[model samples]
Target: MTEGLPMAVPAQGLPPRVRIHEVGARDGLQNEKAVVPTEVKAEFIHRLAHAGLTTIEATSFVRPEWVPQLADAERLFPMLADLGGAPDIELPVLVPNGRGLDRAIALGARRIAVFGSATESFAKANLNRTVDESLAMFEPVVARARDDRMWVRGYLSMCFGDPWEGPVPIHQVVRVAKALRDMGCDELSLGDTIGVATPGHVQTLLAELNEEGVPTDVLAVHFHDTYGQALANTLAALQHGVTTVDASAGGLGGCPYAKSATGNLATEDLVWMLDGLGIETGVDLGRLVATSGWLAERLGRPSPSRTVRALSHKE
Candidate 1:
């Protein structure tokens, strides 16, 4: 399909609203070669809140030795803790295991994210464990978060395919997702880790999950734009009743393990599509674009978002 192709969006009368989890501040900038200042990260998140993003993945509480970019997770949270940008906004941090979860909780994090891979090799490369082992590691973390009354979101990576082990099995993805949900995760995000998913692949997976009686309400979709199919795959998810979508503003993230993977779907483009569908994201498209452009300039590169480029040219 061509860029910005208009399609038949579901009627506005649909019962549920799609919730977008904006991850530009953390995931997008983490892959950047240059270091983004903590203050700038805070401002970026503040602007996103102003644009009506209620759920934002704020930062990662991982070791500096691995991802030095988000080493300021502790410092960043406290700085924005009192900003009061949005009344019920959710700021989640990526917490791999006990150590990361501890740091997140120490910083007063109310929400923590745990991600596991569908493919064993990708799991090993990304988290240094097998798929089962990775899920097992989260057992304690999820329990602790539940005890503290904190929100926990689980991410199943390589749901569609893996760079190391291509064409991930649908059963594997479903298994990991079910495991996370069983462990008391509030939501499970199925990721197209290498951006190899097509609308058909997405529909098939959704159907399989539906057949298994998975709770659609607790499911989300995370797509990358590697083959220019992120939005298409998102539309497929919407058709399957998935209302929670994850995107990075300005198209700012990439998979370090998946060499050909592009950034996450652009929030600008996703908002544009949802707006045409009369979906209520409560996000102001113009302000979101402006903030994305500002960061793109700061990073000294053009944005990967088709909507951003088109809108910028129009201006």
Candidate 2:
């Protein structure tokens, strides 16, 4: 947690803290057609930190061929390593495999995330492997990360729907999530990659997971705004006691594979909704909006955050 920020304990006694993982640097910049300059990426990260976002996904360690935009991770992470007068924040990079992990570790990454999709077809298409094969690949990587004493987060993409296989089976999602949890992931982020999840779908899955005794503490929600349901789905997850939700600054991301999807839930929008519900996020709304505006300008487009738009208009 970022220190010195005042805690917001809800008057109604809601859990006083929720983890908001900022993925704008990696996930947000990954899908961009135009290469975001290394200096620009660095400044974006600095603004995010000043906005009180404690956990920011700094970059990805994948091969340049896979994601050319983040090819600069090697350099970007090193520059950010010296930020905030001692790197007080948690900066996690996405590592696709052992090679990616090696690059991330070389860049002094203390934390990393691995990607996996729940549906077999989706996994094969996105990761070029079956669901089981994907898990198998992560086993060694997770072991190595644990040996290094680094925090590992598992990303389960297409948790709700898939382009090739629509409406993923509940059992399939549960099986994969349980496998990742058993593999020693500190957190499992269930992604609505295509943004097809509803509040009911979220509740149903959580209910089933609860019955199976999967700890909700290790769960996080990652939602896209395809059908404009990301915020609604996030609210449902919050009701189920899921305290961690992934959001991108300015909604600056989308699936390069999943068509018609917008991006991760906008951080400003998510924070605004949480604040209205009297939930605690430890994020300054004005600073967050400013950061979003700055990034939106960098991207040369308008921010997709409705809350940001409304607040800025009022001001």
Candidate 3:
């Protein structure tokens, strides 16, 4: 265990304990061209829980035709009723609209997330509606979830850049983010959907959001490694007092609508960095590495996580 560990050197001006929101089971596998069996998805999530990931996203309640890989959301989610008896673990799922929300609620999903885009192009491409129209659609979904006293997370994609629209203005992102926050979202996960965000851009966005009355305490960051800036952007967000981060196991998924976007920030890699900084993530680095390696084997490809590759020694 020590051989693969990093020397703990606590950093200043960073959150003491960062909560990693694991998105592999939902975001990662949703883009798989080959359908991953429902049993494999359940076992994969179980493995993630055993590796000490407390907030593993279980699955999405989107239309089966839209995301065929996750078509078994009905069957796959029920299998995770017991997360190896891990107490206080969160299993959030994505809900696109009221229908999605209804299905999730019927299945007893307590923590749900709504995916939105800052730009009109992505909103239309992903949701087939204008930005305002999509927000209108999500309004009821968020309200219903909140009315049920369930935790709601708003995922604002294209916060940094959009492939179709080019660089998304910080103000544009702030507007959409404020709408989501005002709509009873308990937390908001800022997404660099096209993976073009830098550290400075991340800090500025956080600052702008703060200036717009969106407190730092209710914020999370989600980045991609397209330009190799996800870790840097994450560090910037951490420095800005963000404690929640969205990462995928094995760096699995990208935006299906954005061809230029890449895989998410790998959870194992993020844990390695957090461990080095002495930031408590409650994740066992050795176990996380092994989990990614295991998933990679099942996915029929090597993991994109640098830490997993370096530690597995068989890549």
Best by lDDT: 3
- Per model, how many backbone clashes are there? 1, 0, 0
Q: Report, for every candidate in turn, its global Cα lDDT versus the true structure.
A: 0.87, 0.86, 0.92
Residue 15 deviation, candidate 1, in Å?
A: 5.5
Residues 1-315, candidate 2: write the lDDT tens digits. 123122433545345578899998889989999999999999999888888888999998888988899999877887886662455688998998999999988777888899998988778777899999999999999999999999999999988898888889998899999898889899999999989999999989988887777888888999999899999898888878899999998888998877766788999888877776667677888898888887778788888888777767766
lDDT against true structure, model 2: 0.86
lDDT per residue as tens, model 3, 1-315: 368998989988998999999999999999888999999999899888888889999999999999999889999888998862456789999999998998998888899999999999999999999999999999999998999999999999999998887999999999999999999999999999989999999999999999999999999999999999999999999999999999999899998999998899999889999999999988998888888888788889999999899988943
Query: Compared with the true structure, what per-residue lDDT tens digits does model 1 show for residues 1-315?
Result: 223334536564443467899989988988999889998899899889888898989999989988989988878898788643446798988998999998988878888899888889988988889889998899999999999999899998899988767788898888777788889999889899889999999988888877776777888999999999999999888888889999999999998777778899999999989877867788888889889998898889999898899888867
Which 10 residues in a row give candidate 2 its minimum summed lDDT? Answer: 1-10
Clashing pairs in 1: 28-252
Could you tell which candidate, 2 or 3, scores higher by lDDT? Answer: 3
Indicate the residue-level lDDT of 55 in model 2.
90
Ranking by TM-score: 3, 1, 2
